[model samples]
Target chain A: MTFPADLVGLLALLGALFVLLGSLGIVKLSSYLLRLHAATKASTLGVGAILLASALHFSARDGGASLIEVLAAILLFATVPVSAQMLARAALHLHPDLAPPQPDSGSRQTVPEGAEVARPNHGNSAPADRL
Target chain B: MIAIAMFITGAAMLLAALRLLLGPTIEDRVLALDTLYVDALALLVLMGIALESRVYFETALVMAVLGFVATVAVAAYLRRGRIMP
Candidate 1:
């Protein structure tokens, strides 16, 4: 789509930021489930924003191509989440063990006189849930 | 206009791929793949606009469908050790 110099730069920058965030999530998260959440959310936002900007830019430049522009955004909205969810479900399947083990939050305990109560022992598995 | 964005987007995709390759577990790779699909789709659309051709959108749509199916199929296979499971 043809856009003025300033506007095109701005749109591109915004789009890039969105994509960057999505990519960043991959490295930052600890587990597959967490990574899936971050990756999918950021990617959707990134692509959605960029496409939206593109649609606007294109519409402003040429009136006739408006339909295509709208379609672009719609397609992004409809497809990204579904695919991401599917992938995430698959990932959990692939590595059932990858799901974060539940955290062992110690049971509530009264402090003994001059002695600290011991936290609940997490035996073998960490006590925690996933993202 | 699109050239710069495409470059950046492509770079970001590579960064995500780095995680995909190095992830400690199979699930991590799947998450990376999910992100990759999104990035690829975005690139497809941007390319369409850059080249001024609606033809790219068709490819993008096919990508959307194909990626979803593949992901779902893979997930099923992983979950139960069988496709139906």
Candidate 2:
């Protein structure tokens, strides 16, 4: 079973590029929460791409599909969002001031649970002062 | 081609490490560590492909599982001030 070297190379190159972008985002983003968003979202896709390239490469080289790479990818995909959510909550808990202001409208929907717990009076005041 | 990919992956890991070192808060450090592990996993997979070896794949799998568990545990600790409620 022979595979096109160029095709595999392309996948690997793209995967590496995305992974680099994600890490660069972590370094470049100003705030902790935005960095979390960047790392989790972009890096998950980046790892997925690399795993995909590996799966394709192995399946072609060995004449059979590689289940391990697929499983690893699935495990990563399943856990990233959960970890990101937990970390975001933790960040909010540790620093409620980092939470962005509620929309000008009366209703407040996106406030994190940790923010509510940490700053009960945060609802009435301006986040800028807190920051 | 694969060598270039490996080089890019290595650079990513270095950038993540820089964040881990210079991050102001615990949450930032944790986020940086998480990104580091994920990039490490990607690097392992790329290594497996480059070396035509199966062991790197298994190592990557183990790393993914461990990294997820560790991140969750740390996050839980940060949120509730305890690993277990």
Which candidate gets the maximum TM-score versus the true structure? 2
Tell how far residue B49 is off in model 1, in angstroms. Answer: 2.8
- In DockQ, how does model 1 score against the reference complex? 0.55
Regions of model 2 farther than 4 Å from truth: A1-3, A105-131
Worst 10 residues of 1 chain A by lDDT: A103-112
> Interface-residue RMSD per candidate?
2.3, 0.7
Candidate 2, residue B49: the lDDT equals 84
What value of lDDT does candidate 2 attain over all alpha carbons? 0.87
- C-alpha TM-scores of all predictions: 0.73, 0.85
For model 2, residues A51-109, the per-residue Cα lDDT tens digits are: 88888888888888788888998899999999999999999998998898765432434
> Which pairs clash inside model 2?
none
Off by over 4 Å in 1: A1-5, A90-131
Give per-residue CA lDDT, model 2, range B1-70, as digits (tens): 8899999999999999999999989988898888989999988888888898988977888898899999
